[model samples]
Target chain A: MVENRPFLSFLTHLVLIVGVVIVVFPVYLAFVASTHGNGDFLSGLVPLLPGPNLIENYRLMLTEGISTAGAPPLWIMLGNSLVIAIIIAVGKIAISLLSAYAIVFFKFPFRLLAFWIIFITLMLPVEVRIIPTFKVVADLGLLNSYVGLTLPLIASATATFLFRQFFLTIPDELMEAARVDGAGPLKFFRDILLPLSRTNIAALFVILFIYGWVQYLWPLLVTTDSRYYTVVMGIKRLAATADGEPQWHLVMAAVMLAMLPPVLVVIFMQRLFVKGLVETEK
Target chain B: MATINLVDLKKNYGSVPAVKGINLSVKDGELIVLVGPSGCGKSTLLRMVAGLESVTSGRIEIAGRDVVKAEPAERDIAMVFQNYALYPHMTVRQNLEYGLKNRGTPREEIDRRVKEAADILEIGPMLDRKPRQLSGGQRQRVAMGRAIVREPAAFLFDEPLSNLDAKLRVQMRVEIRKLQRRLKTTSLYVTHDQLEAMTLADRLVVMNNGLVEQLGTPTEVYDRPATLFVAGFIGSPPMNLLSLESIAGAPGFEGLNLPDGTDVIGIRPDQLVLDQPTGQNLALAASVELLEPIGGESHLHVRLTGSNQAVILSVPGRPDIAEGAAVTLYARPADLHPFNRESGRRTDTAVANP
Candidate 1:
């Protein structure tokens, strides 16, 4: 831009185009495959263009699903995913906000120890502690339930840390001002601190919603009941039928459905998400 | 309005004392300004009064009631912060209404106070705008409006205008003084700016190193600074403090009778004259080092003829004085303040030979 080098600009465009193609190619292929008939994938490398059986594949997946594989209908799985995503997003925000507030504002014994304990959990992802976590959930009789799918995933160190960082950047004088305004601690937290955190909460919701939705291994581990299966894990069952070559058309259709809600969320709330992400991390 | 008293208020952070024992009685409806350079504990004292900081070893009483153990809210005081601390999410109306609402004021009363405050601040048109939408000066007004609506027993201002531009700062300073006079609220304002303190305060409490160096009206402190710290800290171009030993042999001291332990002399730059007068008690020959013409007055930086100790003299308009030129400066005996170097206290009992 500084020198106005046409060649460099052309090179930049070429590189961006290549990057975009690489990212978009797979989703395009999945859509193409979802539009095809059953025989297309069996004879050749999946279809590259729109097929005439698009409505049939999507309708079958949404209404009856591939029942032979023990997967529930797409609508039921999608609904489960929706419920799990919302609960995890809202739950993580609530707990993290309260914890972050306490950690940042109050002076209590063992506060640093508490913060470090929460911070240590960041190093331990769900995959690392999956087995023990599953046993605990099963022992609590939360297995095959929505709580089983979401609660374990709700204790997020990232979201807590984000809120803590955001809270720290707020001027100390604001707190003093609130105190002088006759607001007690809870009142200050509710009236001043919470409203100020709106953007951060929304931003974290988008990321956490996606995080809760795309969970495959955790849901696969806990929910043996078909009714509790989320679309993300249910797509695996649709793809791995017991006795035949997998139904590529329906599986691809289910995959498209599973990715849509979160993708739309990120797109629609793009501005707030970017702002929240940048500010909280700062 | 009510009198606020701080009796031997002290604060320490892990054995490091930030505010040493300080005692002051702020009269009802008086605008007291706590002023010093940064780290002077003026803010700490203000915060203690506001119940935002804990007092280590003394008491803060508001309206004759001991509030040492009370929360900030329970203390019944309002504060305007240095940054204006307006809630970014709330409209000006909401910000003003927030405090009264929390206190469970009746809806009609809240609206009445909010309207009155908005009218007083002349922010009526901006009541629906967020703080971020307002300018710095407007935000400052909203901050004050928030305090005004509370109608607390006292108002605590923590360097509220320090963040504005120079022009706006002066404007807000005048407006704040006018507003305080009209409201007659017991206010404790803090600032590191001496000019703001001098202009806005009914009485000024000048602080240094966590101690009150001087507490008096602006004129009293300026005319008779209690110590070397107050003498140097309160004035612009600061008072010229020269050790008496440096000019002990000067001609003007031939018939002078001074206090026994007097070692330092403070002379205001404005009091130093270019021409020797008939009744002036002190005269010294100085070599001009530099001249700074600041609009209507010129500051002549000069060194004593026999010593390297430099002193400044403020003369009206541009003077026909050049750098390195020898000029005789005179001061009346009454204008020269002598102090003991060890105690830094003015040796006011000094009697000069008549």
Candidate 2:
């Protein structure tokens, strides 16, 4: 039995080691292509290790790569993304928490209808509504701005659905207790309900941040001017070359940079996400 | 402290009526328990009063204020939940002080109320601990402390002890009764456990299928139940109700020979006796079907002579009879409850003396 146990673990370790390499190789390729010159990238000599050309590539990227179409600098785009993302994540989650709280904790007219309507939105993919959404954004004259990018994404259906499920599991007595404590709706949301749902918030934050960052088509349509291009949009155009050629290396570099925030957030946020799900079980 | 009043309270979920039209008045310093079986809408009614639920169509008043339209917060009431809903993130001290702080009460007064509640609940040592860190009983204490610190006009409890184990439920029952008495707060408690209702309530409201079957003091409801539903519902081992037509007073059976038209006879098992000296008295001969030894008492499942039907009798530790053995039993007519079988209403009768 002891021998079998040791053999089983050794086999498990071998499988995981191979699995991680397969998953990480594409990311490693992106990081490697970022440091190499355009020539080395064209020749397809994969940079397996760190290169000394980091500074030269970054300088070129800032001077010409990002400023090609009058778009903001790389750092400016990062800052804009940070602002947009913070607003989108916080706004969407606030709307989600409020709606879920009402549906789960309070009884009112047309509650079931509200629930069904919100749930039905999840049935139709956003891609299906892209044309209609684009027309609405154009009519609102929100083109080429941060508002255009973050507004529609701010009304979340998935987060609200998830949070409502979580809130239902919260005993009705807790809500009653909060009411008895003289906590109004806003006070209850701030003092009791929101504090209790820290884990769910953490989970939703990561989920929403990634969802907002990886957005391409909507941002592409909304921000018609290149000056307002999000990082993802910048990457899409970099590789969409004519004359039977594309900039694979620079495009990968921008993709790698755009991927950084969500990676960092997931690392920091996964702990609370797991903790929140665990707390719900209690 | 203030009284709670419900005028024509009605609650409907879609077309299914939960609490049909009912009126109730809870006086100040009174503890009224709503007792019923599952699906009886007691909890729904309580939530409506708390404003956690809409009235559907009704009026509620607390302290002579028209609170039907008032916010739960504006109503100035407190509630204890069955699951002991202590804020999981907050320490016992913060949980107890949260309301006072939100209400803009003086900081020093908040501390005083928190301290008093902590002392009363004996949770002073655990004030800094989060609710997740406390045991079930301790968490229950903190939930109560959170409400107690509020000092609201009235308190509402929703099956607060139902989550505890049997022994803990009994212990918490007494503890809650003592706590409510000390506070002298008008309280409305809901539970499906009739034992809890009987022991804890100053006045008990018995509900069944969204209707008030009877509302009276525990003794009044127990002794003179207004309906067969009450007689069948409000006791430990519920009262035995056998129709008078189901039996004939044959050879050994000399049971109560009431008028031929009597439909149902209700008798609590303990009121029945064995070895009757007067054959003419209320007595019957029955074959013992099953004998259950329940520690200090034995429950006999007996089949009366000349009848194929059964009746359960709760007697002392042991009765001198084997399971299949036939024996004569005696009971007083004062212990008998005659009910109009079709309507399930009580027939006029005399009460039994202990």
Candidate 3:
């Protein structure tokens, strides 16, 4: 911008173009595979061009699915994914918001100790505690239920920290003003704090929804009942048939379906997501 | 609307005292301005009165009721903050109505109060707009409007205009003064700016280092500052404080009877005359060091000829004086403020004879 550097600008554009292509190449290949017949992949390296069997592959996957793999229809898996993602996103936001509000506004014994304990949980991901978490869920008889799938993942340290940081940035005077305005604590949280946190909640929702949707290990570990299988984890069952040969067309179709909702969410809420992400970090 | 009494109010953050015991009575419907530099605890005192900060000890009474254990809302006070603190997501109308609604005011009552506040603040057109959409001054009006709609027992302003531009600050200062006069609301306003303090306060409480240095009418504090700190802090260009030894041998002080412990004397820059006038009791020969011509007046900085101490004199228009030129400055007996050097307390009696 400072100088009229045409060559440098050209080089910059070229690098970005290369980056975009590298990132989009795999999705493009999957889309191409989804549009082909199963026979096209048997000939050797999967066909690069579109085939006439696109509609049939997707329709078959969505309605009847691959019966041999014991996987339900694509629509059913997509519905389950949607429900689990919504619950996880909403639940995490609600819990994190309340905890963050309490930490920022109230004085209690061992307050910092409580905050530190929550912060320390960031070091232990679900993968590390998966076995114990599963045992607890099974003990509670919550396996195969929506609550079991979402509740275990709802206590997000990152989300709570983000909310806490955002709450700290709110001018202390605002709270004072609310207090002087005759608003009790719950009323202030409801009428002022929640409305102010709209963008943050939305942004966290996008991130958490994607997080819930892409869950493979936890859902696989818990949901033996196909009724609760998420589309993200269900695609694995569809791909790894008992014969060892994956139905390349149908698997690719399921993959595309599994990736669509989250991708759409990110694309549509991009502005709020970016704003929320940057502000929460601040 | 109500009187506020702070009875030995104190606050401590752990072991560090923010506001040492402060006792002051704000008369009914009086606007009391607490003026001090940052860290002087003026704001801390105000917050304690507003119930925003807890009192480490003592009591705060509004309308003769003890509010030491009460919530801020229960204290019946409204505060306008430095940052305005207008809810960013709410419309100006909604911001004004939020408190009334929370208190379960009827729909018609809320509407009437909101309209009255909007009319007074001249923000009727922007009531539907969010805070971010309005200009800074408009947002400030909305903040005031929010406080106005509450019709509480008192109003507390914590450096509310400190964030505005100089022109807007002056404008808002006049408007706030006019509004308080019309509403007859007991108010406690805080600011570090002495000019704002002097102009807006019915009575000014000058604070320093977590204590009240002096409290009086603006004219009283300016004309008779009780302590060296008040004298130095309250005036523009500040009162020129000089050691008694520096002026011991200067002209016109040969036979003056002075107090024994009087070591420092303060002179207002405007009262230091360049010409020898009738009834002038003190005169000092000094050489000019600098002349700052600010529009209609000039500030002449001069050093005493026999000593290195510098003093400033405010003269009308530009004086025909050059740097390094010898000048004689005069002051009457009443203009000289005498104080004890050790304790920084005023030592001069009410009467001074030359």
Which one wins on lDDT?
A: 3
Q: Clash pairs of candidate 2?
A: none
- Better-scoring candidate (lDDT), 1 or 3: 3
- Put down candidate 2 lDDT per residue, A1-282, tens digits, no spaces: 456687899998999999999999988878887777666756556668766666776666555674444445566566667777888899989899999989987779999999999989887656788888878988999988888888877887888999998887877666677777777777888877787788889888888888887777788888767667788777767776655456566666667778889899989988997786676633
Model 3 / residue B330 / CA error / Å: 1.4
Model 3 over residues B71-172: C-alpha lDDT tens digits?
998888889999998888888999999888888999999999999999999999998998888888998999999999999999999999989999999999
Model 2 DockQ class: medium
RMSD of 3: 2.5
State the lDDT of candidate 2 residue by residue for B1-354, as single tens digits.
998889999999999999998799999999999999999999999988888888889889898888888877788888888888887788888888888887899988998998999889899999999888888888888888888988988889989988888998898889999999999999999999989999999999999988899999999899888789999998868888877755445433354555444688888888767757453546677889999989899999888877767878888977667889987767666667778878778767434344
Q: Which candidate is the best by TM-score?
A: 1
lDDT of 2 at B50: 87
Evaluated at residue B91, the lDDT of candidate 3 is 86
Candidate 3 lDDT over A43-70, as tens digits, reads: 7886778888889999999999888999
Per-candidate TM-scores read 0.96, 0.85, 0.94
Worst 10 residues of 2 chain A by lDDT: A66-75
Chain A of candidate 3 gets a TM-score of 0.96
Local error of candidate 1 at B216, Å? 1.3
